[model samples]
Each structure stands twice: as C-alpha cells, then as structure tokens.
Target: MTRSTITGTAPPEAGATDPGRTTAAVPRTGRLTPWLVLALVVLAGSAVLALTIGPANITAAEVLGSTRYHVLTWLAEHGLGFLDPGENPLSRIRDAIVWEGRAPRLFTAAAVGAGLALSGAVMQAITRNPLADPYLLGVSSGAALGAVAVLLLGFTLALPLAAFIGALAALGATLALAGIGGRLTPSRTILAGIAVAQGASALVSFAIVASAQGDSYREIINWLLGSVAGASWSSVAIAVGALVLIGTVLLASARTLDAFTFGDTAAASLGVHVTRTRWLLLTITALLVGAMVAVSGSIGFIGLVVPHVVRLLLGARHARLLPVAALVGAVFLLWADTGARTFFAPSEVPVGILTAAIGAPVFAWLLLRTRGQS
Candidate 1:
C-alpha cells in the first residue's frame, strides 16, 4: 500500500490499477463482457420503455418513429417515416407524451439513482459504515420537511430553495453533533444522522398536521415518499448538475476513500488528511443528497443497497464498485419506478414504497448471510 498523490480535481484520471503489472499482465477480474453487453442492452431497452410506457398508453412503435425521426431529421434524410404533423391524433399526442413528458422523468430517475448510490458508496467508505445511505442520513427527510412545508404553505415557487436550506442545515446539525472536541468519528456520525432523521420526522408530522389545506396532505405525503411522476427538464437539469459534480469529486478521492476503510488512524498514517477530508466529503455528499431529494422526493434503499451489492460483486474496490454501483442504482430505480407506475395500471404506487419492499427482503437476506459468516 502506497500513498498516491491527489491530482487536480475533475473526472478521475486513469492510472495503472495494478502498479507492478502492465495492462497485458493484469488478470481480468472476471468475465465482464457478458455483463457489459447485458447492461448496455438493458440501458437502451429501458430508455425505449421509459420513453414509451406510461399512463398515456403509447406503443413502442410510435416511440421508435419519433426517436428515429429526430435522428434522421438531423442527417437531412426523409426516410424515418414519422407520421404527418396532423395526420393522426394518436401519434401527435403519443409523440408529445413520450418525447416531452416521460423521457425527462426517466432520465432523471437514472441520473438520480446513480448520484445517490455513488454518494452512498463514498459515505460508507468515509464513515466505514455498512448502513450509510443518503436518505437514511437525514438528508432526504430534512429536505422533505422543507419542501413539504413549502407545498402546504403555497410556496411552490420557493420549494427547491427551502429544501436546500433544510438539507444544509441538517448536515450542519449532524456534523456538529458528531464532533468531539474538534473531530468526528464514524459511530458519532451515524448517531447524529439517526438523531437528525428523528427530528426531521417530527417536524414533518407537525407541518402536515397543521396544514390549512387538508386535501393537499395526501399528495404531499406521496411526494415525500418519493416519485418521479412530474419530473421535467428544468428539474432534471439540477439533478444532472449535482450528479456530475458529486460523482467527479467522489471518484477523484477513490483511493483516499479506500484508505479510510482500513480505519481513520490507518488512513491518516497513509498521508490522507483523515478528519478534514471526511468533513469536506460528507458535506459535499449531503449537499448532493439534499438537491436530489428536492426533485425526486425521498427515494430510499438505493443509497444503502446499491453500494453493498456492487461491493459484493467487485470485492470492495471503490474504483470498480463506484461506477458499477452507479449503473446498478440507475437501472434498479428506473425499473422500480416503472413497476410502481405500471403494476397496478390506472393507479400508481409511490416508488419509495416499492423500494422499501424490495430492499427490506434483500436486507434481511444480507443480514442473515453476515450472521452465518460470523
């Protein structure tokens, strides 16, 4: 184990993962070809279904038509065969629904999932906590309290801002509580997050109970539980920006993050600024989570589960696990959201509920495995 120099902060710089071995000499971790091909096809297929499948009842063929037309139109070709502008009512509405309405939401789901999962992986490494997750750390709950209050008070204009404020404040509180003398420990950090979650939950209850508009509470609660139902380009822009910023920062510190897993004292011995890096990284992650929760609501389990799954597959290396976890998170949430919206047809369940249902069983199985190993 050697201390590596931290380079200029941006997307990660590719370096030789195995220092002693050249590329040709390095052994393949496993057969990634099949999985890589599968992931590509799934992503592409998911995009098609995400664009086409919704409450709108548009067919995949119409989605292909509109998408093909866009590509061919760019090439000055006329063979895409998109229906005429006013020839059919179904095609017109179908194009609008798929291209305009659903695509952005689905893209947001993928991006948000990746962002949350990436952040979670970093946090788990930084804190050395298997249970670390964005939503579980009170970031989502704090954002929900702020966003929910804004909704109930007819301050839709300020909802995102309010959510950001709550998220930052919550992070501040968590850090303050976690600090001892001047530094934080992983256990303290986890405890503070749990306390903040409880506090935010109480605040949410009060806000809902005191709302003047009783009718809006159900819809507001649904949003708190998380949904990408009304996601649009404007909000997706914010999510995408958060994803890029946080993903870059975390990946930049991947080696340092891996060091933290060996314990803070051990990491510090390796020339990593154990305390300062943890503070900066955790705050950055909280900011990212807060921003995500504002738009997508409190989509849970993604932050906790995706990283663990990736670690299990990749053998605890942050470099490989981080990117793969991001992809898995994206794919998992996109499909989870799809199931929530489509499983019951005319009625859509909150995706959060679906995530919880799927995550809980998997979580139990994981716990059982851990116990068995112990």
Candidate 2:
C-alpha cells in the first residue's frame, strides 16, 4: 500500500510547509486546534482535581494555596529568598497532603502517560502496524523481571536502575534476533520481541513462585500490577526528565513518522533514510519506555488506546496526533489512577488493574470497529 492508500491523502510537494501535510488534507488543522486546546484545559483541570481527591477532604482552594506556598519556598531555596510569599499558607498537615501525598504522584502519572502514548504512536508509524506499542518490544516484561529479582533476592540496589538495565538488555536481544537473517523487518521485530518477553516473564514468575516471602511477595505483586501510590519527588524528576528529553526528539520527528506511515520503501524514497531512522527511533523509544516502566511498573493500554482515539478524531497527521495524544493520555491515566485508589475506599487496588479493565473493553470495541471497516 502507498501513502495515499493508507492516509487518503497524496504525498506532498517539495516546498510544502510540512512535508507530511498534503494540500488535500490540510483543512483539518482548523478542526484539530480546538481539540488540542480542550485537551490542554482538561489535563490541567484533571491534575488540580486529582490533588483534591482521596480519603482526605481537601478542597481545591487548599490544593492551590499549598501549591503556591511551596512554589515560593522552592524558589527561595534556589537563591531567590527575596521573593518570599509569607509564612505557610495552610496547616502543616494540609500542606503535606497536597505536596507530600498527591502532587508528585499526579506529575509522575502525567509524565509516564505522555511518554508511553508518544512512544506508541511513533512505534506504530515506524512499524506501519497499528498493534505496535511501547511494550511491543519486551521492555515491560524485562523491567518486571529485574524488579522481581531485586525484591526476591533482598537486594539493597535501587529498583529503578535494575529495571532500566533489564529493559535495555531486552531491547538489545530483540533487535539482535530481529536482525539475524537479514534486514530488520517489522514482522521479525515483533516476533523477536514476543520471544524475549515470554522468556523474561517466565523468569519473573519462577522467581516469585520459588523465592517470594511475606511482604516482599506483596511488594513484587504491586509493582507488577503498576501503582503510583509510592511516587515521590524523585519519581516525578525521573519521569518528567525522561519525557522532556526523549519525548521532544520524538515529537520533532513527526514529519519523519509521517513519511514512515506508508512503508520503508516509501519513506526512503522521500529522503527519510529508512533503515537508520527506524533503528534510531526504536532505540530512543526503548530508552523512554525503560525510564517510564522503571518509575511506574508496566502500566498498559494508555499507549495503545490514546493515539488511535486521537487519530480517529484529528486525522493521521503526526504533528497533531503526537502532542494531542500525549495530553489526552495524561488525562486518561490521571483519572484512572485516581479511581483505582478511591473506588474501593480503604483498599487500594493497583492502577494497572483498573487500566486493563477499562482498556480491554475499549480495545474490543476498537477491534470490532476496524473489522467492520474491512
């Protein structure tokens, strides 16, 4: 299939404002702008709303007040003490609830969600396969294996570092296997990743079954299921740092991704250096995924679902799809995580469980819709 066949828009002329934007498809920018604005507004509102939730009855006013006071204090500590915003605006308990309890987790969720969704969109484009996602390369399973090893062995090592190392190792193995016979095609990459994932998952299961004990067992289980309840200021730093650093590169490659939509041959013809671009993008994506899974263990479906939903509404233009999908994914997971913590009152379920439950039915609907189109 060609670019026109898949996107229903012809290739661009050399001097087009965006090489990915064809004149025939340019009109949707007007429609896409409002959705982008709405997604930004909703994401901001959701972040504030998430802070006010939980067993505590903190109001939005308290959330905002605590946020302002802390922001000023942070600035003062960084050599701007002249700009002090007075004494603590709220009681220490209330400030702790906003700053220590919910704020970091909220930022972590948004960062991880945005990273995963952006990676998924890029993966799908590079592979020219709608089923590709952040985990399609075995990063999650590898991270889980590493985390389980740390927990079961009673190691004092940092869990995120171990998980990140495992994810990189898995990516290396998958790429090596995919390149064994000849060129690294998407089909070969996918199959190699599946094999690696299964191997890592088996090891993780064995470690849990054979060595897990008491509290460690529960800790392993929670990490595998994904929860941001343990998120701290460090978690926010790690997650947001990775998102800003790698996610920017992915976003800047939007036109390249658009070139990739048709296939390697089409992309190469359009001056995209298909082979090099594919490998580089895959490696970059793996790094981003590794970082996210290290912080929030193997959260699923936001990547798979959000990009497609955005494309359905905003067209397949990568420039629009990537950012909008990021914002929407952040909002989606924020609410989902909030519900996971609050829905059962005293008992806190894993956020991954909630995501899978919601994502499964939505995925089924998307699948059926695709089949019907065929």
TM-score winner: 2
TM-score of each: 0.83, 0.91
Q: In model 2, which runs have C-alpha deviations exceeding 4 angstroms? A: 1-33, 81-84
Per-residue lDDT tens digits for candidate 1, residues 1-374, read 11223232433433446554433323325544444456667877887876666676677777776676666565455564354432232466666777677777787888888888888898888888888888646787788878877888677666667887888778888888889575688888888889998999898888888873655887787878888877888678888889888788887787888788789889999999988998899989888888888778888888888888777665576766676777788888888888877898778888889998998888788788779756
How much is 64 displaced in model 2, in angstroms? 1.0
**Cα deviation of 193 in candidate 2 (Å)?**
0.5
lDDT of prediction 2: 0.85
What's model 1's TM-score? 0.83
lDDT values, one for every candidate: 0.77, 0.85
